[model samples]
Target: MKPSFLASLLLAAVLGAGGSILLTHASPAQAQTSTASTDTVTIFVDATFGFRKKHMATQLTKTHAEYAARGYRYVDMAPYNENGDLVGFFVTYSKQ
Candidate 1:
């Protein structure tokens, strides 16, 4: 092969390798995000009786406060009851 042909081949190989390195280094911003998992869970708070209702209120407040500090938010909620009385609340929390 000619000397010029060899030089061009080497130049192309070098440029390809350099481009690969640059691409690897260029995407660091994407890697900096979200090592923590996005997750979901449902918590059941019972409000069966007068004392239970009070306890459930405090517990729901405390649970929300705890999860909020850890980047969790309410996704959905359902109130469960028998007849006209409150039975429980199912609160869905998500961290995204």
Candidate 2:
């Protein structure tokens, strides 16, 4: 009803609207990151006898080809170890 009270109410409404807008909108980078995360799949190869370079290389090559044919691209590869022993490998692929 009073002038000061009306001004305060308007300010509060503006601040609330701005906060809601900010919280509801996502940046481009964040949107892309979330999309990329969901579009990626990790392939794990089990090696009971430990990782041999030649065998692992051949297996990875075949895997790359298989995924590539399905419109996927290689993203990353890392060795998986357990108790100080080389166990297998984790290969990550993402949709192109």
Candidate 3:
């Protein structure tokens, strides 16, 4: 192996690792602002399976009532799929 080739490989590895670390880790100021802005937002997973399928309606009704009592309102829901089938939903709620 040539010395120049080995140096280039080492430099490439260091730069790649540094770039990934910088992208994944949040800075202190960003973390603080994100937490403060999202304080009024909450997420919940409502999963429906064979065992709980029968009571899904009533369960959702109670969930709505409970959150409403605490001032959180339903904002949006996205399907949570497994493989190619629907499994549950990612529900978002917000309190203002």
Best-matching candidate per TM-score: 2
lDDT rank order:
1, 2, 3
What is the lDDT, from 0 to 100, of the residue 6 in candidate 3?
Answer: 100
Q: What CA root-mean-square deviation does each model show from the true structure?
A: 21.5, 16.3, 10.1
- Model 2: lowest-lDDT 10 consecutive positions: 24-33
lDDT of each: 0.68, 0.67, 0.57
State the TM-score for model 1. Answer: 0.50
lDDT of 2 by residue, 2-93 (tens): 99999999999999989844533322111123363468777676444232445766777888999899898899988876667655677888
TM-score of 3: 0.48
- lDDT score of residue 70 within candidate 3: 83
lDDT string for model 1 (1-96, tens) is 999999999999999989855543342111112335667767666565343466776877887898799888888878876567776677877885
Alpha-carbon runs more than 4 Å astray in model 3? 1-38, 49-52
Ranking of all candidate structures by their TM-score, best first? 2, 1, 3
Clashes of 1: 0
Off by over 4 Å in 1: 1-37, 49-52
- Give the TM-score of each candidate: 0.50, 0.53, 0.48
Backbone collision tally, model 3: 0
